[model samples]
Target: MDYRKIREAIIEETSRTHVHLVEVLGDTITTRLLKDFPEVSQVKLRISKPAAFSDCDAVGIEFLVHR
Candidate 1:
């Protein structure tokens, strides 16, 4: 596990993390994920709507929260 490879693996794992903005369930999901993955002591949640627009193909918000 080289440093860069380990970092890339972490990045890849985190890349799949998401929160859907419309359902108001992002918080719930975040809480659950935080509980399930203790490695995630804190996380910067990014919610986006890439399909909601054409120009930017996205809009989002970030929340820096911790358990």
Candidate 2:
């Protein structure tokens, strides 16, 4: 798997977003990966908002994408 490409895409897309929702970010990353990498039939993304809460460890979302 070309992890470097995937990471670059995710970073490029997610870094300049007005909507900071984890679900949206996850979906965007998955879509980008699927489009860029045909070998990736499925993508699983986990986002953790570590600074969102003071008491809890983190609040995040997980998403799965399938072609």
Candidate 3:
């Protein structure tokens, strides 16, 4: 697999996405990855927002996808 190409694809999708929810962003990224890279059987993604609360270090959502 071309790691550079994969990274570029992810970056492209992220830059173009304009979503209000983290879940939707994650889904968009996962969908792009699966579509662009057929060899990728699974995807593990974490979307985090640091300093989201004074009491916590960060808040985020993680998801695993299988193709």
Q: lDDT tens digits, residues 2-62, model 2?
A: 7898888888988876765778878878888899999999988888989698889899998
State the lDDT of candidate 1 residue by residue for 1-67, as single tens digits. Answer: 2446444544554455653443344465456556656666775667666768777877766666787
TM-scores for all predictions = 0.49, 0.85, 0.89
Clashes of 2: 0
Q: Give the TM-score of candidate 3.
A: 0.89
Clashes of each: 0, 0, 0
Question: Which candidate number would show the highest TM-score if scored against the true structure?
Answer: 3
Q: Rank the candidates by TM-score, best first.
A: 3, 2, 1
On lDDT, the candidate that comes out on top is 3
lDDT of 1 at 21: 45
Q: State residue 29's C-alpha deviation in candidate 2, in Å.
A: 0.8
